[model samples]
Target chain A: MNTTTVDREDLRTLVAETLDLDVAEVTDTADFVNELDVDSLMALEVMVVLERRYAVKLDEKRLAEITSLENAHRLLTEALEKKG
Target chain B: MQTTMASGASAEALAVVAMVREVQDHRGPEIPLLLLNCLERLTGAGEADVVIRRPRGRRPTAQLDGRTIYLSVSHSAQMAAATASYRPAGIDIERVREVRNVDGVRAHITGFLPRHADATREPDAHAEVLRAWTRYEATVKALGVGRALVPSEFAGNAEPDITFRGLNLPLNLNTATLHTHRRNQHDSYLLSVAARPTSNVVIHHDSDLGYTPANHERHTS
Candidate 1:
């Protein structure tokens, strides 16, 4: 079991830095594209950074799932659990 | 566009940018329908039986009398926009806000935008850089390669107009039919469009988006 546990704050900060957003703005429900206006490049950058840092493969379809802090945390948790 | 242009019909084409206003939810189905209505108003395709196929997150294609027209849509907050062209088209709209962490060119690939030496000293530098980002983005999306954003290909100074207007500086790729036309609409939003403009591309502003059913009725009548 790869007991790697990623917390919400850590994931939020990672996403915030990647998207260049203020940590407060990347709230639980803010849609990356709709609300924060994060373009595809920004979104892809987050994916690349997360995949590299977490050492997990994120599919393009799953890429759509990581829109906000809440979902991102869930996705990473699921990916980490599966990695084990 | 430092990266090559997307292949389609770029010659002698009719490019149009249409705006939809007061859209409560950009993700709702009504957004596409409203944009389709705008397309109908521009192309007069209402005369023929048209069929449109729009998958989520994909550009919608409409077949009218055996001719295919490409449509690209973008929305921000309460406003939505759709760009149509006989050739491959891509557009993006953004609610312009503060630009941050603009350390340098590579640091802010979307907007390294102090085009000239003294340009960065301007007070509206943040907004200007954000505007530059819009042009760069719309041009890339026009490539039709779906979600392809290459930072190294970005050119801060392309089709440099060097003027600040309702529609500010044009983007890099200036060709016969297609390039990018960007504007600051409502003083708080930025819009950019890329299409084949060989046949006099026409663009409508958000101000005109209030085009109600009566307007359409009068046009068709």
Candidate 2:
């Protein structure tokens, strides 16, 4: 199986599409709750999107740390590596 | 007369009177934070900050100044509310709107219903479904399980010990007795409050507490 590397753009696109914001607006430094105006449901949706996109299951508690694009990319990469 | 009533009411009784304020001016996503701020001021929890514990795939619990205070927040369309009390409580408010197709939503909730569940079919099934959804949400909320609890878990003996009441929040000051009436659709939205060990749930409107509604709109996220 080919290893698909999760990149920053992939995480940014997912966040932008989940929140219906412009892709340009989802800066790597932006906070999910403070910048993207995400409540708990939206946050969960972001996780769900990531899970489906990567076909990898993630513990919800860990998603708490994926509050920014930078964080999301790092976490998703780690999860993918473990899956591989 | 004032002193008599004040003396008669216990601290817990006073806490039973939860505040349900509408901070519609704030954007939808920002309402929860505003509600916490409002709750802190109302409880006189000075210098106490709001904290939330987010469990993945579940609703988070709101804490005030490190103390566990029962809080339920809901927002739909343009309106938002924050319900705060000393006891375990849950509040839900939904915007009443026409749904062209409720079959999918109903199917999702069907497993939660008992075998002998009524309302198998009706003219107002859509509206009834919305009401039921709110009650279920409020009940789970009061149970402190939030969405993490499944409908099947609510089956039989696993049911939560909760009672719901409906209040008509007036455009002005008003007082109400808790658990007096089963929740009914109010205005354009459905409001429900669920609490364990049902008590006289009184709604203390902002004006009743000398909290002008304008104060709610003053804060911005």
Candidate 3:
């Protein structure tokens, strides 16, 4: 388990609330666009929120490649860890 | 202003814009001609370089210049929301007349509607169907691909919130953005705009361009 500055659990909750998805269904491998069916506009909204919460600027191209819950977790963990 | 012929890559790459105005049920061919004329004036392109696709009877028509200037005109008011991005990019507007139950609709067409869309207030059945249809059409238009690709191919994919399956589309095509704008006129209309990412988008009222009020209606219910 990667303990980073950004809490994975919190991220999951945010995703669920923002996208109106079942929190339990969000898995590490669940792709936001493919598995969760989150639209691009919503995705942008998520990015905006994440930036404000984490104080990090994610690259647009990089954000586009993140598909599953696991990918998001890994990216967030890595980013937060680097910030520390 | 007299039409002047200029020679250069900038002039050659210019996009030919077109418009069609239906006033008092007087649908004249001149609307499209004037639109093309305006495009010619805007881009300084000659008729030989422009490609016009006008469908017979009642259908959508598109004018294109290698994905640079793609213009699709539809008299249907339902199409207004989809055309808000027309100034700098291509737009496709559509209106739905029916939709199935939300649960069933998502079960079958989840790929088309993003999760956020599901969370948003469910629009009328027809409106929901129209939104998805216009988004798909706008994506195709932005890619400069005709209706050759199977709609099912775009059914299941995941990446960005907005995804375009360019499986067989030309290599030059990249990304497409979908936006919906509601117009309140004689009835409600939705417009969708699709264009290359490099292009800028500008939305203006018909009145702003000196178009007679009788031709363009207010965007309100």
Candidate 4:
């Protein structure tokens, strides 16, 4: 399995593509809801993708605390770090 | 007051007590109160900082320390969904009887459902719908975004299995585990609990003081 470092921009692009939203709408500070209009279902979808992409598990309670592109990026990074 | 159990008892072996009060049946904020009571008993803290959301126009409330604990509540069936997480959590219990325009919802939130549309065409279509909806709901609650996130933006490729006519919806996450129970025979209400990856989970029935008679005796003795 390739353990290459996954970049934040890559996650941003993936999220944008998966959700079919404009990439320009997503920013480090953009709220998943306010900016991209992500709902509960969409959030879970992103979660599933992250787990599959990174091969990491996210605690639901911890996932609840994430609210933005930046938050997701940070979490994915932490999960990757733990892997290393 | 520490309730002493039998010597050599491990904390994990100790039964977590839960209190269930059907205050308003389907109307009151009984679940939150039950959770608060359980937390109070479990933690032995008279009152700690807590936040609760209820269905409808109820506002979420919190109290620092008091016999009559304050709870902020709202009425959103969406809030009751459960997701696998590191913490012991609660989910919503509602039986959805119909599918309201899946095509429209799909257009908006395609990522939440499975890729195989045939899976949704079984005799248990209603159950599948509820299962999918609840899984999404539970995930959102676990994530703490509640209804703040739109239904359209959830995205993922893996599809979880739906078993028992919607009794189970696969979470498809590496870290969390999903367990569900159907309380009534008609399957009118579904309760799902999600927690971190653990070998075994003890489901405490609320009315039984969160203990089985066997475990209670084991602890009391």
| lDDT (10s digit) by residue, model 2, range B143-220 | 676665543344342112221222221111111111111145233444455553323344444342222111111110
Give per-model TM-scores: 0.59, 0.51, 0.41, 0.39
On a 0 to 1 TM-score scale, where does candidate 1 land against the true structure? 0.59
- The clash count for each model shown is 2, 2, 24, 28
Regions more than 4 Å wrong, model 2: A1-4, B1-15, B18-77, B92-116, B119-194, B202-221
Model 3 in CAPRI terms: which quality? incorrect
Task: Evaluate residue A79 in candidate 2 and report its C-alpha lDDT on the 0 to 100 scale.
Answer: 80
Number of the predicted model whose lDDT against the real structure is largest: 1
Q: Return the TM-scores of chain A for each candidate in numbered order.
A: 0.86, 0.88, 0.76, 0.83
Per TM-score, what order, best first? 1, 2, 3, 4
For the predicted complex of model 1, DockQ is 0.13
Candidate 4 per-residue C-alpha lDDT over B1-221 given as tens digits, one digit per residue, 9 for 90 to 100: 12222233234423223222223332345555555665455445543464444445232333334322222111123222211112333243334344443343344444545466443322355444444565555444434455555444465433432222234332221111122232532223333322222212233333322221111111123
lDDT of 1 by residue, B1-221 (tens): 01122222324345453443456766787677766775786577673467777777666878776787777776655667676656676666655454443333224353324444433222365555554555555665566655443443353432433222223333222211111223544435555555543323444544433221111101111
DockQ of all candidate complexes: 0.13, 0.06, 0.02, 0.04
Residue pairs clashing, model 2? B178-B200, B178-B201
lDDT of 3 by residue, A1-84 (tens): 533666778888877776677889887677776556554434544654665567775554455445666666667667777766
Residue-level lDDT for B192 in candidate 4: 33
CA-only RMSD, every prediction: 10.7, 11.5, 16.4, 14.5
Query: A1-84, model 4: which lDDT tens digit per residue?
Result: 446466878888888876677888788888886556554445655766777677887654464546788888877777777777
